[model samples]
Target: MYVLIPAYEPDMRMIALIESLKETNPQPGIIIVDDGSGACYEELFQTASRMGCIVLTHETNRGKGCALKTGFSYLKGIGASGEVVCADSDGQHLPKDIMRVGSCVEPDSRSMVLGGRRFSGKVPLRSRFGNSATRFVYARSTGVKIHDTQTGLRGYSTDMLDFLLEVPGERFEYEMNVLLTAAKYGYAIKEITIDTVYLNNNESSHFRPIADSASVYLPFLKFSGSSLISGAVDFVLVLLLHSLSSSLILAVWGVRCISALLNYTLNRNVVFFKESGIRHRTAFPRYALLAVLIACLNYLLLFLLYKKAGIPLPLAKILTEIPLFLLSYWSQKSFIFTLLNPNG
Candidate 1:
């Protein structure tokens, strides 16, 4: 097994982590990518190289996502056998945890193994809230409940290297994008509980709260934009057509078909543009089927809440939409606009 560490301007603890890993029985092969850390950090990289690690360098910082891809490409070039695990250089991921994740990597199994960290005891507020918000968004969007969306401790079996290299993202957002599209490529996620250790309250992390957060949430934001615009069109057309034709069913169905087309166009062209192996022929039918099912459920929920439960129609419509919105997003992400890999 090989452990890939992406380091940029790292501290001495990373060296310590490597030394500790070397001490373990049947020590794992270590590969480190120096993500454009300048001369000041060269000493650390030298020490790692002298200690028998394969050190790859980038002249300028290319971001974590790119560094990971570098390691994956290199591994493939060398014909690396056994498991491949990635860990942060900030010392948050313990050696034991790294090995635990590596142990979970099944050969030829399409699984992304993650070292799940439980944030117990003292934790930074930003870290806590950021994780909570990301977890909520990921779960609501993908219908996959992952406790740690931002964890750097992840393992991939040999079969997933090509997929990892193909996933889009240059920096912090890349890891999130992997989870967002993993299922679409026929990969299952396996989580192993690991310790949560924050050094100096995560001060060493290079994550920019404003910029990186926007990048990480870009897909979710785009999806929301498409849905909002489509919903608005649907809303306006429903009222306008109903006033003209005096047929609620005709107005609703007409608006639904129109709005779904707009949503599908935006999603395929913009929201999920990075995904492959899906075209209009395969996706449109799946999207339309999901839309019909969602429309039926929307009416069913509206009927139950408004007529049976004595709630106002306006308020019931709003209430019914919340679940439907999540359903729609999950279906589009995991089913409609996803890749189907024949190998995996």
Candidate 2:
């Protein structure tokens, strides 16, 4: 096994972490990628080297992704072909959890082991909500049912290293990008709960809420945009049908029904795009149920807006269905085209 730590301006706590790992029953190769924490922290690197661990140095401060890439290159350079466990410099990860994840790694390890954080018992409200939202987005985008999407402590087999290295984000978002890419490449990612230790309640976190969220959510937002196009199609069809036949309220519903089916089909094939091979069996029925739910809610809201609010029927149909559009996106992501199919 190989242990990789990406450190940036780490303190004495990190030395303690290294010492703990060194004392493990069956020790593993340790590689520290110093992301240009420079002369001040060279003593730790020197100590790590003296302890028979490889210390790979970066001249400048590169983001976490670059540090990880550097670590993979170092692993390849040393001819080490085993599982690599990446833990943070901040000492939030416990050594036992690393070993637990390591135990799951086989000779030809092909899966990624994520150290899932069980954030229970009065975890900070903002932290809990933030993680929950990101987890949902990641699960929807990648079809990986992970509880913690941003956990830095993870184990990836040697074969999976190249995939992680090629991922595109520079910082924390790189983790999310890798998750999506792993799903794209058909890699199996399993999550196991690990002890939670918040060194500073995330005081050292480098996350910029808005900017990082934009990076993380860019794909989902694009998916939502696609759903919007579908919504527009459904809306236009409902309006057109209402105009052609005044008595055919059922006809308007039928047009929306057809349009929703088209929207769901395209979104399933192109937007969420998971290959469950369930099109013939579960896909249509599940989608039909979702469409019916969305249509009923949309109609009720449109009726209320048009009759009670005294708005034009066509205009009300457009206005009231906006919320329903968002609802359908979430519904479809969570239920409709998800990887819950047994085959997937």
Candidate 3:
């Protein structure tokens, strides 16, 4: 196994962690990325190098995601194939836990093993709340429940190097993107419980709560916003056209046609925006097909809810959308804009 550590403006604790890892039985190859810690931290990195860690340096501070990619790229270039485990340099992860995560990386099983931390002890307020909120949003957005979406200690086979390099996000969001992409592509994520260690309320962490949190949550929020805008347009068009024409079918078709066009555009351009290498020729037809199916379902449900169910027209419209909203989101993510090779 190769251990990848991304360090920025780190202290002696980083060197200590390196030495401890060296002491492990069957020590793994260590790669420490110097994310522009500058000359002041040169001596510490030198010590890590002397301790048999291949230290890669960056002239300027790249974010954690960039640093990790640098390490992965280095490993790939060297043709090193085995388990690659990523651990934080802040000493929050125990050496034993790192080894445990490394051990969990199975060559045959194409899955990422995460060292899941349960924030049990006196955890930082921001750490606890940020993790909780991220967990909830991640689960709802991907329909995959990952308890520790923010954990840095994760292990995966070298075969995932190319995929990880392709995943977007330059900072904290990159990790979240990895998990989201994994869920979308059907990559199994196995979590191994590890000891939770918070040093000085995790003050050593360089994560910007507001900025990083926004990056992490931006995808889901954009998806929700696009859906809301489309739904609003659909609702308004349905009511206005229905009131004027007194034809439910006409109203539903007209509203959905317009709304689906707008939703597809927004989703393609903004929400799940990426250079997917999938053209509109391929995606549009699938999306349109889904839209038609959804429109038919919407009309049927609305008709039943408003007519037979005795629900108010407005209430029925809202009720009809509740379930379809989830269905639309998942469909777009899973089938429409999904990666061609999710397992990678």
Clash count, candidate 3? 0
TM-score of 2: 0.68
For candidate 3, give the lDDT of residue 25.
Answer: 49
What TM-score, over all chains together, does every model reach? Answer: 0.92, 0.68, 0.91
RMSD of each: 2.1, 7.3, 2.4
| Better structure of 1 and 2 per TM-score | 1
Cα TM-score of candidate 1: 0.92
Whose TM-score is greatest here?
1
Model 3 misplaced stretches (Cα beyond 4 Å): 299-319, 342-344
C-alpha-based local distance difference test score of model 1:
0.87
lDDT of 2 by residue, 87-169 (tens): 98778889999988877776565568889998976565556777888888776554568888878888888866656666677
Write the candidate numbers in order of decreasing TM-score.
Answer: 1, 3, 2
- Candidate 1 stretches with Cα past 4 Å from truth are 342-344
Predicted candidate 1 versus true structure: per-residue lDDT over 52-154, tens digit per residue:
8999999999999999999999999988878999999889998888988998899988788989888899988778877887888888876788998888999
Residue 315 displacement in candidate 1 (angstroms)? 2.4
- For 1-344, candidate 3 gives per-residue lDDT tens digits of 89999999998789888878888844689999999999999999998898889999999998999999999999999998989999999899999999999898998566999999998878898888889988987887778888899999999999889888888878888898899888877779999999999888788899877789997777668888998899899889999999999999899888988998899899999987773456788889999999888878988999999999899999998899888878887778777876567433
Cα error, candidate 2, residue 44 (Å): 3.0
How many residue pairs collide in each prediction? Answer: 0, 0, 0
Give lDDT: candidate 1, residue 274. 71
Q: Which scores better on TM-score, 1 or 3?
A: 1
lDDT of each: 0.87, 0.76, 0.88
